[model samples]
Target: VESLGRDGLAMAKSLNMGNIFIRKKDSNSLVPNCEKHGVKAFSIEAGRALKLDYDYADKMVDGLLNFLRKVGILEGDEETIESQSVYTTKEIVPAPISGFFKPNATLGEKVKKKQRICQVTPFFKSRPKSVSAPVDGKLIYLRSEEVVSEGDSVAHIIR
Candidate 1:
């Protein structure tokens, strides 16, 4: 059965969208259940939580239409791109200590293992906690809020 939660990277490459694989294993979720049941399902996180970006919406619509065409479910041409980025290896780097997070890596930036991605300064006067990359990958997401608590997700990396 196709992992729709589709072969995520495949759909992204076909539609030329920002290809990010959501890693959620050993958890209760519908996507995985669909896979087990042989139901071809797909999941996509379109814009931010509340706000809507019309341009992004339009792009996604176009991609969906093109995907239909590419699969022969619809007529006409497909606008498949030459090469698209597929970010896999999902890693959520958590804050080691409760403090304010100061990021050293920007989103979409490539980082190496052991590289300082951010530092959390404690509320009390003391040395800040050094947050380093656990693996060599691209920095995909970083928390916007500076105030962080222990074990909070500070960064997301994908290889």
Candidate 2:
């Protein structure tokens, strides 16, 4: 169990997944494999470990479509992903002032620079002050139910 190599780790050896979905299965191998009387084939590359850009997502979709087409699992369009907003990571929005944040806008929302996207409470208090975007981009994530100690990522700008 502990001596398995990184590539040799098993996720699920089954004929079917049966409505169960497992994320981050590669990190823990034996935990994902359960039950008896079924085939055991591990899909090593099931998900991503880090944030993905539009290009990466497109490539992944294309690869999956091709694989499914080859195996006769899917018969449809060749999978065309059109990204409405594709921005480079170089255009990021940094925290102006660190504090307990409460996001006002949702992810993928187009925001302009200097527009209020979230607010920060000095000590998790009521009536928080707003934090504006430094660059025009889509908000990716907001620190959900987390305690940020200052300059710790309140929201992401994807311009």
Candidate 3:
């Protein structure tokens, strides 16, 4: 059961993207099949990008190796792999009215409460309505689509 992870969602490719959940019994069956074939498998959720941090990539590799060791595919001491905890309290900023969105904040940038995050200008109007952050947090993602409907999600903030 392969699926696009959170990175795909960050790219705006799919609406439902995150960790994949499997029933415990199903997972029990799946693990043995992978073990029999000497395959180590796991899932990860991350942001979308053309390039990734080298340090993060290395850590992922180390984590995979540790998983292999735990599942009997390899024999070694369990290596400690540190991972950054992801904050899940996300704020989905919605469009106040249908318009073309001009974002002021970049992805992964820190934002303060009440900061202007974007502006939405209706196609027929010259004035744009400014959107502000409701809480202090980091900008997790911004909508790639310029045109949006009223109440559509314009950006996501992680507090």
Error (Å) of candidate 1 at residue 126 is 5.3
Colliding pairs, model 1: 3-6, 4-41, 5-41
lDDT of 3 by residue, 64-156 (tens): 666556555779865432333335367889999998999998987889999999999998999999999999988877887889999999888
Highest TM-score: give the candidate number: 1
The clash count of every prediction, one per candidate, is: 3, 3, 0
RMSD in order of candidates: 3.5, 11.9, 9.9
Clashing pairs in 3: none
Lowest summed lDDT window (length 10), candidate 1: 1-10
Candidate 2 TM-score, C-alpha based: 0.47
RMSD of 2: 11.9
Model 2 Cα lDDT, one tens digit per residue, 34-144: 313354333423223455567756655666555455445888633323222323352444455556667778866878888988777766456667778888866655656
Q: All candidates' TM-scores?
A: 0.75, 0.47, 0.56
Kindly give the stretch of ten consecutive residues in candidate 2 with the minimal lDDT sum: 11-20
RMSD of 3: 9.9
In candidate 3, stretches whose alpha carbon ends up further than 4 angstroms from where it belongs are 1-88
